[model samples]
Target: MAGTAPSPSGAAAAAESVSDLNYLLRPLHWTAVLRHPSGAGRSPLCFRLYTFAMASFTLSFFCSEVIVLYREGTADLDVFTLTLSVADTDIIWLFRMAHAIVCERAFHKLALQVGRDFAEFVTWDDIPVLRVQCRKVRRFTLTYISFGIGACSCYLVSPVSAEGLPFILALPFDATQPLGFGVTWVYCMITTLHVVVMTMILDSFNVSLIAQLRMQITLLSSKIVSLAKEVSERPENYSETYAQYELRYRLLKCIRHHQTIIKNADLLERSLGAMLLAQSLSIGASACFQMFQIATSENLALAAYDAVTSLQECPLSLKRSLLLLMHRAQRPLRVTAGGFFPLSRESFVSVVNVSYSFFAILRNFKNEEE
Candidate 1:
């Protein structure tokens, strides 16, 4: 629901395209059902089913990970590599948990606000821009899911050797046995799909939040331009008093829009701040390790893929508004990583550069030792 954008006609039907695909904010919808039963309408039953299934898969995955960690210490080179391979999955789990917490807490209010704004303020003119943003989100979601499937398939299908049967993950129990192996494989496959779906939904939600903010900013910019044009024109039929009153009314309306935009941005920060901080740190480390592995080994395309998957693109108009908004706000609307750095593409590239530098240092140290 959040990710869906109006079409060029500003038709409500445009939002329906994403209704069934709305996998991100079930808490917001269902909680409102409990709070206002008469007004809640019929809720989507699939949201509840998906949520429950993912929860079960998440628990199973976590237990399996713990078992693996306990069985094989990272002291071994192979074990360390194996750990790096599943690093993205671990981070996705963190994001999913953070999202669930936010949804259960205050995200419902934000969702309500978003729906209200879309209904009242968004015009057909705004739809095209919003559609572009939604398309970008969809592309990123597909990329993440595709790469996830590819990685899981590779790991699961690898040949078994004399040392032991290679597992999708490290297990304390003997997975070489038929029953044990079958159960582990199935669990890993299901968990892999779970992670893929969550990653797509959660990441799309982030993009949707930013896109909606950008829409408000774009509308505000247009309003400002229109008001300026109106003030510049003097009509021969208008009285000065009537002109002044009209200007005042328009100005007040514009101010209200501006205020609403700021409030929405603030709400977004409250909902996503902690998760962005964690994501920033996780992605930095993931990118570093990925680049390192890519440089040193050939079987690490998955790492490279993970490094690329989290990047989100901003539209050109939205980019301009971001600059304007930053200039207006003394503090700016930045999502910071522990107050050290902002979570953005520039920062992501910087992290990659830092990772490369660290890899160089490690390589030099190894060479010196040799």
Candidate 2:
């Protein structure tokens, strides 16, 4: 709000006619975003490397899930060709969560700070459109919240887990392991496409939010300058007190506008960051999960790099995780789905065995942690 750019001739006219569209609409090249945003302060490569690694893991895990589902005969061959319609409800809520974080918590409080800054600059007429956008964001956010609840609660409760116990995962060491390497590549291609398309869509939403903020800021800047000029030119036509009041009123209005913009940006920062975080987690978890799956059929060291590359997957790993978790319904019913109630299994010992076995497998590995 304080940094003043030197004004150009007819700047006000140009501002009024400037394009309202604020962000780029094309699919993203994450490298560019990281390069520009990180500048001299932090290593952009740090985040990029971490994210890319995570994404790779997620795709691998998802491919494992798809393979498992195929083994169960629940999905069709066409599923291999189909693009999944993403469940964006979680996304919308993620945005809301960011807003609440800024408004109510510490990490995103910058939103409030920025909002306060922007409020110092805009007017009343501009408020209506901005308000409308806020309301839309709210509604979008609420729907996402509702969706997350339903996905976790409604679909996770399965019946098969308790009944069969460990029969499914008991690895018939000789159980004709899943498809061959050719099949692995097939699975990779399918999953890779899923990741790409979904990520583009996901990235677009964040970019759109940024674009909207940019456009609004430009509009508000013009309005503020226009108001200042009008007051200056007409001062002789009004009483001293009236002119002072008008000036104060306009300044206050701008303050409010500045606050709103700042709030929105802050909300977006956290929201966008959280989104990327969620994606990162998905990518990492799914990649690990897939590595675990591939290890099930193929050699562990055979494709370490491919395992790492799974992070490039666009949509990251959340949906894949959800889908894989959904498959858990038939496997051991750790999650909800297939029935309205929890499985009737003995809990404490089973949980311990599963947890212990998962870690014990690690100790036997002769390979370095690399």
Candidate 3:
């Protein structure tokens, strides 16, 4: 189950095992960022077109605001803040769109591999674990969507109450007129909804993958620790050779399982490294670090050592396998930010310190201006 390729017959079963993730992926499909798993919904050309249209609409709005700001030459802090906020969101959305387009094939491959890997856990009587994690992921995703919708509602409605456009964009027509206001308002609503919903889906999808990876690692650690107990429980009639064979087989499976885990982590980093780097820079290092708690390899090594010590009389081959597992696990498994720095707590601190230094310099410059 560990390193073995998924069989054709097991494909559907593997898909079923991780069906819970569709809660995240389904929204992405609707947004045309990805296609439906069954490949029944939209065509590739349609997805590409939809993405391009949305990106163009959002970028046009962003440019309108920038042009207005430049023309007005206003020093109002509120106006400046609003334009800055829009710019930030627009940049993030554009980056997400680019990622969806560039990594489309990689995403599909990763999804299939994830489903296949998760199938291995099904035989371990770990359905409950998967279910528990699925429930958590569902709750988190729904809660996030709810909040996003709520915020978007408030943003779209605020201008209605105040009798203005939702955002400060330079339109050709008189936006104060009823017809112009209606059109502009609807445009803002659509763009805002796109940005908010797509952002949530992409971010939540990444987090869900990390969460599932963490769960797999946890299950693997538990399996390693229980190896000795499982081998000891063999039937009384079982000979030493059979017991040794059983131990060796299970140990090899664990090794393969670890290899699969490492492969998934590397795939994730490769496919989403740029997006992760952009998110870390835009959202802050703390958020990135929180999302990157993918695996605890040291615990895996400890569990292997414990399994070896628990065995009253381990064979030389089995002992060597355990030693190798320990050695491999000792080297931490991590995802990096665009192949640059690792997404660890230490890196988070370094980012924060650098950000603060820059902030201080800007503050000093502003003070001198005053």
Candidate 4:
């Protein structure tokens, strides 16, 4: 009965809400990070070839930089700093690319499952909640993409003004010659832009998944609260048996909804766990960004408890179901990185502190050397 006989307009709204998830991931599909959700079977041959070529180029560029750095040495402070910066960028890019490739299947399945959930669980009344979250996601995606592109443009243009390649690498031909310089510049431009865009898309994809999970948890809490209200307001003419049956039916739906949320959370963790761990270590704010979902999930237990406690008279069987819901909610859904650490505020603070300590040590070492 949930999705049955929806009005044409209502159905359109539901489809729009469902499309948000796919829209957020459209870039990933184009980049071959993950195949299109609508397509079946393995990714097309062209996508595979594109992925291979981009990955090969990235790895080759990284290796070239490292070899050149090693051959020239890093005794000069400027050269040392430049080499470090280049290495950091290339390493992170390679790590992200590798992670995407490894988790491609998991990501593909997770995206499809989430899409189905959106289509089935979203209703006319649920439109407001979905819309709110969708707007936030759209805003975030736009801001992130704009900032990344703007920054990358500046980086690429700076080299042009200075009459140098965007990145320093040892090529076979003399890059200073006009023809060689033109080819080298174009190559750097293409590879650098690809890395920047791919990194942004991957990060956005993960964030969008977290947002979807939080939205589902919010919906579950809303359903539980509504269940209590509806049961309490039952008409006086209704028979006790009928009331009990209705309550049980509605409660069962809520339970199933909770289960779906749990399943999706697990899938998300499996798909991005190791990648998240790497991100948290590399970017101090990554863990902090995930704390919102954790907080929302933890509140679900309290919501369930309050909803059930408000009922004046409840059947023992119904109470048992409510108790089970509370117990399950108390666990507080979490997404962990490689099953090693949960992404939370505490983890964020720890990562920041560790990063700062390393920076301080490096500073001291440099000062001493100077």
Candidate 5:
């Protein structure tokens, strides 16, 4: 399993494991499978349609929202709420488009290798840990999508008769006619579902990849520790030269494992660097706007809720493994925005502080005017 091809049974099991880890991305994978159904099974036509649909609908909505916000110019607290909602929508689509354009091919290649790559780390000892990790991610994704659906459903029904409000808050548009309103409402629902699913899928990809990398680092560390113990306990069996040779041979193996870990991390960054950068900026902007709203408006519940939800969920286990992985590697894998700010817990906290400072300034200006 370490250096040779997996047996037939093993391969089958590995495939199942890969599929389980990829549950979130099943829609995208199925799309690819159906699109071509042969040799790479990546259809240009299908991809174009997916990209076109996401961009056209999301961008059109974003443009409409921006136009309305510009015309209204934050005359009231509702404007901030509308702006916050628009930013959230914009960020989701931004990552979706970036994924389609930048990471599509790389993502497919990585997906294809999942079975083989994962087999290297999964063993009887680590199998339980792997299962627990998978279940955690699965639960998070399910809960995340469930929450989105609930929120969207409430928004859909809150309007008096589904004809009083646009599907999304946007520039004044005609949706007075029953048919027009129905179509707009349906489009918005579809768009929201698509965005939520794609976002979960993308997050799943990163979480799984990082989990695997951490597993490798953990296994490698264990091997190194074991090898050192072996050398210390069994030095009587080996002559000086032979003992040195054995140690060197094992060290080389460990070095190769470490190199593989780095390679995987490099591949991940290459595919997702730009997308992560955009997400970091988008999330930061969303959180900042929500913070501003809470500070300025009497209605605290919605803005506070939005702010809490906008924060990304980082599992404690994954965070620990990541910290360990970075420590073991001696080089942290950073996703940076234009090489200026690295996306990490530190950067996220910095963003919040900066947002709060801006909110303070705005509050002071308002106080002076009052």
Candidate 6:
């Protein structure tokens, strides 16, 4: 059922249809419930941010109606048409918020699960767990900053007349509204903030994920080497030999498990990288295309056309990135808000799970070789 319905008022009926059509075009599409075991608890974690955002968006919707009534009149058709536009904007924002909520759930779940498992993992005391934690911390901090900027940029922009106000601006006021220089100023500021934050987050997360995987590989390799030495040194004594055999067996199993984890980590990294690449290219193309349009020279239209052509190619880039990562993980994920987040940790888990599954399939590639 829809919120808007056709009012009996002859002229108003037309506006209601407009609103309904807008909603129909972009209904919520999250058929995939997050597969996290204990993710219900974490949903509340993102509630504050998203709820505030939704509230703001809803406020904007209401305000736009008020603005319309103020500028125009209570004419049924006019008000109804305005309501339709506001409803359309709200629908888009709602879907976007849903995506953020879903991604946040996954990020929290992967982090918690990984932390729990790592605690139980029996590895050498010399392994750099604390260092790995630090890396993750840096990644998260940077990602939060970057994602904040990127999200705001992609989702909302304030009017030039009200840059000092909240992001929730009244609708274009009228179809003939003209934006002044202030709009560009605000846009520039927001864009600069977005780049700085996204770069910081991506770099931190990438370095941390790689470092954590490398450390895991190092710890497992060391254990395997030590276990091999123990087994080889006492092959003759039955009790000593038996103890050595069990030790070697366990270490070998750990090595195999770790190997799988590493493989999946690699896959996830590529997938995440693909997602970020898509976003960067999209943002860049949007900005550059707009830049090309503002020119008044004879070559301006040509420049704009070239920009549009290049910009059009960006979807192909996004598709390629998604395809590469999807093939690695063997999962068809969308180039969506849920699909590209935390930039690194979440991606690592995705790829790691894939790798772990592969290892399970092989069971004992190393031992079989030996």
Best by TM-score: 4
Error of 6 at 311 (Å): 37
lDDT of 6 by residue, 7-85 (tens): 3243233222221211111111111212233335455545355455444644455566556556655454433443444
In model 1, where do residues sit more than 4 Å from their true spots?
Answer: 1-53, 84-88, 91-95, 124-173, 287-370
| Model 5 residue 361 distance off true place after TM-score fit, in angstroms | 36
Candidate 3 residue spans exceeding 4 A from truth: 1-15, 40-43, 160-163, 232-237, 284-370
Per-candidate TM-scores read 0.60, 0.32, 0.70, 0.71, 0.66, 0.39
> Measured by TM-score, how close is model 1 to the native structure?
0.60
Could you say which candidate leads in lDDT?
3
Cα deviation at 276, candidate 4, in Å, is: 1.4
Would you list the clashing residue pairs of candidate 3? Answer: none
Query: Which candidate, 2 or 3, would have the higher lDDT against the true structure?
Result: 3
Quality of model 1 by C-alpha lDDT:
0.58
> Candidate 4 residues 250-319, lDDT tens each?
7887788788888889878887888877766655433333444356677878887897888749887887
Error of 6 at 156 (Å): 14
Global fold similarity of model 2 (TM-score): 0.32
The 10-residue segment of model 4 with minimum total lDDT is 284-293
Where does candidate 4 clash, by residue pair?
A: none
After superposition on all CA atoms, what RMSD does each candidate show versus the true structure? 18.7, 22.7, 23.9, 23.7, 17.7, 21.9
lDDT on C-alpha atoms for all candidate structures:
0.58, 0.43, 0.74, 0.72, 0.61, 0.45
lDDT of 3 by residue, 1-370 (tens): 2323345446436435654567767778887666655674446777778778878988988888778678656465456556656766777788878887787766766665546665554443455566777677778878998898898898887762234767888788888789988998999998889888779888888777777778778778767867866666767887888778777988887898888889888888888899988876766533433343445345889999999899759788998999899988988877789989987779989999999999999989977974
User: Which structure is stronger by TM-score: 2 or 6?
Assistant: 6
Q: Give the clashing pairs for model 5.
A: none
lDDT of 2 at 342: 35
Per-residue lDDT over 1-370 for candidate 5, one digit per residue giving the tens place of the 0 to 100 score: 1223345446436544733654655655443211211234544776667667666777776776676667667776666566557657665666556565556656655554435555543344444555675577677767876776677677766653235663435535568777777777777676665665556556666676666677668667767777777777884656888788878987887787787678777887897787777777777777666656654433334444454445448666755555554444444344576898976568878999999999999989977974
Candidate 5's TM-score reads: 0.66
